[model samples]
Target: MTTDLVVNILRHMLEQAMLISAPVLIAAALISFLLSLAQTLTSLQEQTFTTVPRLLLVGTLILIGLPWFARRMVEYTVHMFTDLHRYLG
Candidate 1:
């Protein structure tokens, strides 16, 4: 494959990764920030207090978003495979 083709493929992959991950990552960040704020306000320094909810929230987000994420990934994989000969040359 040409250098340009490789770069394009890499850029597309990164874009797809970001698209797939953005929702859950954003949720995690917001949850973490809110938890941190709550902890600071309450003087509660327990790691589990912050961690457990974040984990649960992120996990729930992942579960809720899994179908869309899987569909996008599958679509990308299918496209890649279908177009493999173009790259392989």
Candidate 2:
């Protein structure tokens, strides 16, 4: 494949990665922020305070979003495979 093809694939991979991770990251960020606020209010300066809540929230988000993520991934995979001939030749 040419440099342009490689770059295009890399860009697509990055975009897909960002799309898949955005929900989880956003959920984690919100939970972490809230946890931090609570900790600050209570004067409970526990470094690990945000870990469990963030993890749980992100896990729940991942579970809820799994089907949609899988569908999108499969669509991208099929598209890439269908267009493989263009790159391979």
Candidate 3:
């Protein structure tokens, strides 16, 4: 593939990756912030206390969004493969 095509593919891959991860990352960040606030207010600094909630929240979010995530990945793969001929000599 030419440099332009390669760069475009790489950019698309990164964009897809970011889009896929954004929800999980954002949910975790918001949960963590809320947990931190609770910990401060209660003076309860146990590591597991914060850890479990964070994991649970993120896990729940991922599970709920699994279909959407899978669809996005499949769409990306199909798109790349469908356009593969353009990159092949």
Best TM-score goes to which candidate? 3
Note the residue pairs that clash in candidate 2: none
From the highest TM-score down, the ranking of the candidates is 3, 1, 2
Better of 2 and 3 by TM-score: 3
Superposition-based RMSD of candidate 2 using all C-alpha atoms, in angstroms: 1.3
**Model 2, span 1-89: residue lDDT tens:** 99999999989988998999888888788788889899989999877787877877888888999999999899889989999999899
Q: Where does model 1 exceed 4 Å of error?
A: none
Task: Give me the displacement of residue 74 in model 3, in angstroms.
Answer: 0.4
The digit string of per-residue lDDT tens for model 1 on 1-89 reads 89999999999999999999999889889989999999999999999998999989988989889999999999999999999999998
Q: Report how far off residue 63 is in candidate 2 (Å).
A: 0.6
Worst 10 residues of 3 by lDDT: 80-89
Question: What lDDT would each prediction earn against the true structure?
Answer: 0.94, 0.89, 0.94
Error of 1 at 10 (Å): 0.5
**What are the runs in model 3 whose C-alpha is more than 4 Å off?**
none
Residue 14, model 1: lDDT of 99
Model 1: which ten-residue window has the lowest total lDDT? Answer: 55-64
